[model samples]
Target chain A: MKRSNRLIVLTQFFLENPHTHTQLPYFVDLCGTTKSSISEDLDIIHDVFEQQGLGMLHRTTGAGGGVRYIPKNADAYDESFILELCEKLKDPERILPGGYLYMSDLLGDPKTVREIGRIFASRFSEIELDAIVTVATKGIPLAYAVASFLQVPVVIARRDPKVTEGSSVSINYVSGSSRRIQTMVLPKRSLKEGSNVCIIDDFMKAGGTITGITNLLAEFDAEVKAIGVFAEADDEDEERKVTNYTSLIKISEVDTKGNQMEIVPGNFK
Target chain B: MKRSNRLIVLTQFFLENPHTHTQLPYFVDLCGTTKSSISEDLDIIHDVFEQQGLGMLHRTTGAGGGVRYIPKNADAYDESFILELCEKLKDPERILPGGYLYMSDLLGDPKTVREIGRIFASRFSEIELDAIVTVATKGIPLAYAVASFLQVPVVIARRDPKVTEGSSVSINYVSGSSRRIQTMVLPKRSLKEGSNVCIIDDFMKAGGTITGITNLLAEFDAEVKAIGVFAEADDEDEERKVTNYTSLIKISEVDTKGNQMEIVPGNFK
Candidate 1:
């Protein structure tokens, strides 16, 4: 392949396979180029990535050494997208019964969800995590998106266990918003023992679910390295169930009768 | 910026935002280059993409014209990954009680799910889709992955409706394997009326779920443009409930007593 052709192909490869270490010979074979040429190409790619605030490239030397790409925040569109998202969240039209916000459209948006994942991944990038853990349904997309950037597997906890998943570990906890007891199940083999992981969810009320997951991971001797949520409801007067977590958006003072709500960027800093 | 630096950044842009059309001015601004320079850069990128059998670049030469990147099949790793997946599927350890295959590890791996999504996207790329619809839990990742590549939103159906989603359209359908009547729900506003969409699922036994989604879409007058599944079980003696669909792998003659299962590539053609 010509240099121009090789550059584009190699760019896509690194972006798709982030945090993966591959020997130089592999790129050389894929790009139909030499060691020196591939080395120069890597420098250029790394430089542009750094310049754009995209992320940093880590290179190791010796027989086992290789290059790995780690994606960071979306500097290009992060602020603008968050501002736009808050505006959407403030739409009282999104207010559903039981004081819940109807933000499924936002969650369903691929680009929006992907960017949210990137932002969350950026927040927890410094931590070494073995996997991204989340509950089933809504959290599944966000977990997969973060895992995509971190190049890690996503282990989902479901309300109902599947017979196809073999044996599992199940726990019961209070649903913060509804104050109802709920069960969360994880396949026994889905997570490794003593693994370090990050917990992610689409929405948070009193943080009961987060605590539940923390307890569930404890059964496997796993550690929760970090926690992230897309949005948090602050209308509750009682103390939060879980602390020391990150949220992208904060929603408060929801008025269903008047069709209005308050939405702002959360404490991501 | 120089052509080399511009090339790598632009490469990431198109890959991340597939199928999004942008006019010349956007690139000129993004790359900090002149219009002609941007045009030439696009050409080099487009040429290299076509040469690598990646996907065609659609360009228009008018006031409204812009370049759009559409990703096709993963010619590089499609066959090898599927073969490797088949080997993984054939492992006797994966056969669970009641002849279910324990493939959560495969579905949980981001790369595996992303590739499966790409393969499905390649098959349905020619069709214009308003969204990718899937039932909740297992299918969420695959649906989001396909939507990521297709530049479309994903609308997920739930077995249990959440009040947060507002009112919904619910339908009763028979579970293909369990032979029990069940309900699937889609929020009233989640999907627009008269849409064209593709249905994606992780596994199919009797195809009842796919048909349920089809019926649910019917409530909104939405068309099921295409259907794709990662695997299908053929051991059932009865005829399949649905037939107009594509599958990546076939599971047949699963012998739980013998602790073995037969798995092969499915009918992508």
Candidate 2:
């Protein structure tokens, strides 16, 4: 393959796999290149990546050590990408029989999840994101991915404390979906005062969880950097409450009779 | 930084932040290079990564278009890196108050979790991992990360089938720690017949959950590629049952009275 094509393929590999380690000898065999050539190529690629302000390539020395690409700016995404994602969110087929949206597939797709995480990471890169907050159980994966990119910890707000979690600080907030008061809590030491937090979740119906997370952050005297969601139901009025937030896909309106759908960018506005 | 260093750093950035859309203009700005130079460097780095069998880089054109790195050979890692990880897992401080190992911190650590996933992925890369198997709550994240790397689905075996899951296939397995018979289950269609499986969990005390997952996979006539755990409590005979398992840390013994401990590789043998 030409050097240019090879570079593109390689970049895709690293992007797809995060925090992976491999040896140079293995690559030398795979690429049909000499060790010296592989070393020189690595030098060139390393410089280009750094110049791009993407992050740093971490190299481990010795026989077992190799290179790992780490992103410096986690949340960078084009506006059009967000718009396209929003359009998909509006698809009527995604609407379930009972008004619930089918989102398990999107959450399960690694590529989509990665993009969703990057968009948020880019937006919040400048802020000191101490913790990525979410409620169980759908929000856990997104929260974990975003927090991983940011290299920060994620605090899961449970509906009820598990015996495993020891003691926790609880709060009561209005549920956006049920439109009733519900309680959520986290361990006292899980988050500190005056910390910067990013609230993320899988779906947004009435923004109750968002509000709950916001209130919880208040308890810690923390600043809310931004709120992000995988999908937002169209019927809800969540956008009015939060000034800064990002959603990969937006649900516009669900056709109850025909099962058709419409969606637009909630973040692009 | 030199062009070489820039390339390494840029590659790292993409790897760390997977599935992101980054513009060339941003890369140019970050590296203080012209668009042409950044493009050329990207070409070189991409080639190196591919030749090394590290990953693949994808480029999209037009407005809001950018490059993304996808991991190809992420399952490949040096044996020594695995050894070092095993060493770290042996830390005495990891012992909890009870006989249990304090692995929640490790499970919650993104870097550690990513590494653990890579370790298992390396062992099972060529085995056609159909679905990652694990038991409830704590094991979910590890299973998720592994499934993410393998680009496969994860079937969580619930301790008890909740009403939401509908029907399930249950199995009775011996608990490794408690030495008591425990039951675990998976949804009927969760695993296909004659599929290849990879088992992952947070902790393997008596190897009960691992065995449970194995038995569940057997119902589908599936073959297990390998078993992986975040930490293994190194009590006597605990390590005997698990075959082809990898653990990041090991707790040989914990003395509650003196708060003393012994740590080593739980499955090194």
Candidate 3:
């Protein structure tokens, strides 16, 4: 294969399998290139990645040293992305009875979800996460997307536990919207003790659901390292159950009577 | 940048944006390489892709011609993947009441979901799907995964319409497992009328949920191009509501009383 072709294949391999370490000799054999030549290629690839602000390619020195790619923070379109998202959230038709905006459209689109996941993954990349946790239903897709880019597995907390999942750990919490006691369950074997988890969800009204997940994680000695939501409601009357959390978009106001809404960017930083 | 580094960047760009067209001049400006050199690089990349069965690159002729990449069917580890998955499903503990298997763990893993998505995308690439459809909860992740690779949006059919989703269309279908009448709903504007959709799910018994989605699509005058699932029960007692569906693994038998189960490969080919 030509040197350029080898570069192309190597680039795809690394990007597809992020956070994986590969020995230099493995690339040497795959590219059929000399050690020195492979080293040079690595240098060029790393430089381009840095210049483009795509991500970082790290080289570990000493024995067992290898190359690993850590995705760069997705800040290139951070401002515009959030602006466009806020615009979408401002649609009056989306407002429901209890001050909620219909976000299924944004959550379902792959392109939209990819950007949201990238932003969340970028923000939380520094924290070592054992798994991305979310409640079942709408949040599953968002959790899966974030987990995919982070190269981690997703752990779903079910509102109703199924018999097929075997023995499970259950918790009771108050639903923010309904203000009713709700049961959340997770299989006992789904997560390991002492592992750090990142809680994610589609929306945050009173933030009751997120608190429930955090409390549930406590049973297994797991800690909630971070919490992320696609959107969060801003209501002066009702205080948020979970205080420390990040959201991509904030709903400042939702007027179902007049069919008007206000939205703004969240604390992505 | 050197031509080799340019090749690496270009490869990443193309792979990231699959099934999209780009003019040769875009590479010429980006890489600062001559048209002939860029063409030669493309040839090399195309050859390597074909040799590895990664995908294909096609060049349209005439005035508005450009190059496009179409991912080939993911066949690198088809046999092993199914064999390993079958092995996992055969675990007796996975069997639940009424002969269902606990597959939430496999379904939640991003890596596992990606492979499954690739297989489905590979099989349905030729169909030209506008959107991937599924019922709420478990199927959302699988649908999102497939839609991401296929570069389309996901349309989730909710079992119960949320007030937040605005107006919706509801349908009645029998639950294959419980043999009870159930309601499924989808937002009125969630999917475009007459759009071709691929129905995906995590599991299928009598395939009632998929049939429900199919019925819902018909209300909008849309067509069901294909249906794919990760697992399906092979019970002879109950007749399948939907025929001509694709599954990755088949559950031959689930002897919950005996604490045993049998699994086999599905119709990948």
Candidate 4:
């Protein structure tokens, strides 16, 4: 393959398997490229990654150590990218029959989710994250993607306990939508005490669920590193409490009455 | 920046924000490049994506369209990659204090989770997944990761009901570990009827929970595309009903007697 082609393939491979331990010999065998070729490709790939300010590719020297891709910056999503994403959030197809945004497709797409993960990973790259926390269901993917980027374990705050979890630490917080007390819980040993945590979720409505997750994290003596959301419902009241946070897309208003919508990038300020 | 560097940065940008609709004017602004330069860079990025077999860089011309990165073969994690990953699964740190393998970290890591998602995505890429299903809470992340890669919405089967979810469809399945009948539920409208579904979870002990998820999927008239697990308990006697599956690691024996263990990749056979 041409050097350019090889560069693209190598970059994709590295991106696909981030933080994975893979020897040069293995790459050589897989790609049918020589060890020297792989080495040279790595150099080019590393240069490309650094030049883009995307992240870094670190190669471990010792036994059982290999190549691991780590993001050099978190919060790397710029204004234009966020704006473009917010525009897509306005798509009518995203609107469910019952006024809910159809986001499962976006959540499932690897490329989309990876990019979303990268945006948050870039933002939180500086902070040492002990865990990625999210409420059960929708928040799970966002939490998983962000945690995957940070290479941290994720703890899901369940709304209710099930036998599968054995035992859990429960917390009660006011639900943002209902303004009533709602409960959430995490597995008893899921998170370590006094750990730094980043809270992430698919959507933030009243910020109640996040507060619930925040309380759950506190119960473990974990510190809040930062908070992020895929989309934040554009409500002035809810936006007040989520002051120090990042949102990929901000839906300012969803006019179900007129079937119209307004969206913008939220609080990257 | 150099032409090569510009292309790399642009590629990273596009990769990070898939399905985003943005014009060349915006790209020019972000990169400080001219419209023509940005256009050229996009071309290079597209070529690189295709040549690498990563996927296609879809561009929509005319009004209200720009670019989208869709994985051509989202399920293309090669067998060699799976084999190599099996080795990493043997890491000592992965072996926990109580003979439990610390898989939450691997499952939580974005890159590892993406790779894990890809492995399953590649396996079930052609299956037309309607939703990725899992029984909360550990399975939520895995289901989300896989569903994200597949670009489908995930319908989480909760071990119990919560008020927020409203009405739900419930099913009873035998818990593999406890060998007890456990009920799992999903919101009534969460999944569409007759949709193809892929079931995923962080770990499987007796395959009972997955079976529960399968039963829940069926309750909505959804079909199972495939079943996947991050880790499967190594014991052989636990008969699993679902045949189409994949697992990154399998814990055959957790030796509490000697604090030793045996870990291997299961049934990618």
Candidate 5:
């Protein structure tokens, strides 16, 4: 194959399978090119990938070494994206009864969710994760999105256990706001013992749900490597259950009567 | 930039934004190259994409015309991939107490779900879809996967209502097996009127849930352009409710005592 054609094929492989190491001989057979020529192509691709801020095409030598794509986002782009998200949250039309904000539309958008996943993945890029764990329904999309870039499987915790998941480990936790006891279940077969995981959620209030998830994962001996939240409600007066976590956006105030809300960046460091 | 570097960047662009168009002038400025050079690079990428069964880079001329990537699947590859999936589905260990198949592992896999989404996207590639709809729980991941390839938004219907979604339109439907009335909710603002949608589900057993989705979409005056199911039960005598649907795998039998399963390819032309 010509270098141009190989470039197209190589780029597709990297984008589709991030964080997976494929040896040089595989590409040699795939592109029908010499090792030296392939190396030159990879060098050019790596430089362009870095310059474009897409990620890094990490390469290593030796018997068990090869190349892998580590996805990353530029700091400048992430700043602008988070700011725009805060601005969207400030929309008065989003204010609903009982001070809740309507955000299903943004979460429903594939492009927007993909960008959110990219930002979260970039933040947790330094950590080694065996799986992306999240609760059912809303958090599932965000989990899959981050898992795509991290190249790991997603383990979902459901509020109710299903017959299709076989035996499960269930945990009960109290709701922060409602002060109601709720059950969270994880199928025993879904996760392995002592696995490293990152917990993702769409929103956080008193962190009761996240705290519940952390307790549930402990049943299987899985480590909660990191916690990433899309939005965190700002309530400094109320004590929070989970103290160590990262949030992208902070919703300072939700004024239902005024039909307006105050939004700001989260404490992400 | 050199042709090699341009190839890298253009390939990344096409992969990330499928089903969208970009004019030649945009590429000219992006690659820092002449229009002729960019055209040559596109020709190379287009040919490779088609040959590799990655889809097409459709080209058009004139002021409003540009190039778009239309994703498609080759029959030979699709057949082999689906067959392999069936073989995996036939694992005796997947048998639960009541003939339920343990499929959470497969659904939780990002790569596997991605390929499943690609197949569904290819099946409905001809249809112009504004959104992909699916009920909450297991179906959310599949819906997002298909929406990613189709470059459309995902609208999810839930069994329970949440305050953050604002006001919603709820519908009652009979469960296919249990014959119990269940409520399905879709937020009013989640979808627009006269929108074309594709309904995707993780599994279909009498299609009652899908029928409910269709009825709900009717409330918003949306059109059900296509329906895709990951797996369908081979209970021919049961008499399914919804017709005119595509399935990738047909689970013929699940013998709990025998600890074995019979699986085959689904009804896809």
Candidate 6:
């Protein structure tokens, strides 16, 4: 293949498998090129990634050394994107019964979810994550997105364990919003013992659901490395059940009768 | 930036925004390179995509012309991958009551989901999809995956409408396995009228859930362009509620009492 063609294929491979290191010999064999040529191509790719502020490309100059891509920090949420998302979340029609805002539209958008996933992955990138954990329904997609970037498996905790999943471990926790006791279940084989897990969810209210996930992870001897959410409801009167967690959007107020809402960027900003 | 660096950045941009065409002049301004250089880079990227069977790049020569990437046919299911996945599904422990097989592990896996999404995107790439439609829970991730590749949004129908979703339309459909009626809901604004949608789900049994989604879409004046699933149960005795659908894997046999299962590649093979 021509040099340009080789570059395109190489770039695609690197982009698809971020954070994975590939030895120089492997690319040299794949492209049927000299060692120096392969090295030069990688240098160009690395320089471009840095110049565009896309991510970082690290190279180890030794027999075991290789190239890997690390996405930028998730804490550095793009200012324009967050502002636009907050504006959209502030729509009056989004206000529902009991202080809640409609966010499924934003969560379901591929472009928005991709950006959110990248942000979360970037924020938790420093942690040693064995899997992305989340509760069933809405949070599954968010967990899957982050796991994709991190190249890890996603493990969902179900409200009701189906027989299809075989044996499982169940836990009971009080719901923060309803204040009702709810049970969450996870398959025994879904997560490996002693694995480092990053918990994610679509919405957080009082943090009861996340607390339940933490309890469930303990049963398998797994540790909760971090917690991330798309949006979290902020209330002055009610204390949050979970303390250490991150959110992209904060719903400061929701007025159903007044048909209005107060939205702002979360701690991620 | 150097020519090589420009090529990398341009390739990354095109890869990120597949199917969206940007004028040549736009690339020239972004890369600070001449129009001919930009054109040359695109040509090289397009050639590599075609050569590698990764996707397609179409360039318009006229005023409205630009470049776009279209994924290839799902029928190109990497032979080894299907075989390996089928083998994993054949595990007797996966068999459950009523001939259901456990698939949460495969569904939760980013690597597996990525391949399945690519196959689904490839098979339906020809269709003009406005968005990917799916029910809440398991199908959300699958829908999101396909939507990512297609650069479209995902619309999820809920089992029970949450107040946060705003006004919604609900419908009743018979559960093929339980032989009981169940209600499914979707928000009014989730999908636009006259949209061509592709429905996706993790599993299918008599195709009840998919039929429900199709029924729900009709209320919005939308059309079901196609349906895709990760796996479908094979039972000659039971007729599927919906027709004209594709599945990646076939559960030919599931003996719950005996703890035995038979699996194989589906229509895509």
Give the chain B TM-score for each candidate.
0.95, 0.68, 0.93, 0.74, 0.97, 0.94
Q: Per-residue alpha-carbon lDDT of model 5 for A81-167, expressed as tens digits?
A: 889988887788888887888888899888889888888888898899999999987999999999989989999999999989999
Task: Sort all candidates by TM-score, best to worst.
Answer: 5, 1, 6, 3, 2, 4
Cα lDDT of model 4 by residue, A130-159, tens digit: 778887676776777777667777777777
The lDDT of each candidate is 0.87, 0.67, 0.82, 0.69, 0.89, 0.83
Q: What TM-score does candidate 3 reach?
A: 0.94
Give candidate 6 misplaced runs (Cα > 4 Å): A61-63, A73-77, A254-258, B73-77, B96-99, B254-258
Provide the lowest-lDDT 10-residue window in model 5 chain A: A252-261
Candidate with better DockQ, 1 vs 5: 5
Clash pairs detected, candidate 5: none
Q: Which has the higher DockQ value, candidate number 4 or candidate number 5? A: 5
Looking at candidate 2 chain B, the ten consecutive residues that score lowest on lDDT are B94-103
Q: List, residue by residue over A164-208, the lDDT tens digit for candidate 6.
A: 787899999999888999999998879999999999999997888
Fnat measured on candidate 5: 0.93
Sorted on DockQ, best first, the list reads 5, 1, 6, 3, 4, 2
Off by over 4 Å in 1: A74-77, A254-259, B74-76, B254-258
DockQ of each: 0.85, 0.16, 0.70, 0.23, 0.90, 0.73
Give model 3's TM-score for chain A to 2 decimal places.
0.94
What's the CA error at residue A149 for candidate 6, in Å? 0.7
Writing each residue's lDDT as its tens digit, candidate 3 over B70-155 gives 77754756768889988887777777666667888888788789878878887888897788999978888888878877888899
Query: What's the TM-score, to 2 decimals, of chain B in model 4?
Result: 0.74
Ranked by lDDT from best down, the candidates are 5, 1, 6, 3, 4, 2
Q: Residue B66 in model 3: shift from native, Å?
A: 2.1
Model 4: per-residue Cα lDDT at residue A67: 77
Model 6 docking tier (incorrect/acceptable/medium/high): medium
Write candidate 6's Cα lDDT for B13-71 as tens digits.
87677767678888889988888888888778777777787787788898777778786
Superposition error at B169 for model 2 (Å): 6.6
Candidate 1, pairs of clashing residues? none
User: Each candidate: RMSD to true structure?
Assistant: 1.8, 9.5, 2.2, 7.6, 1.5, 2.0
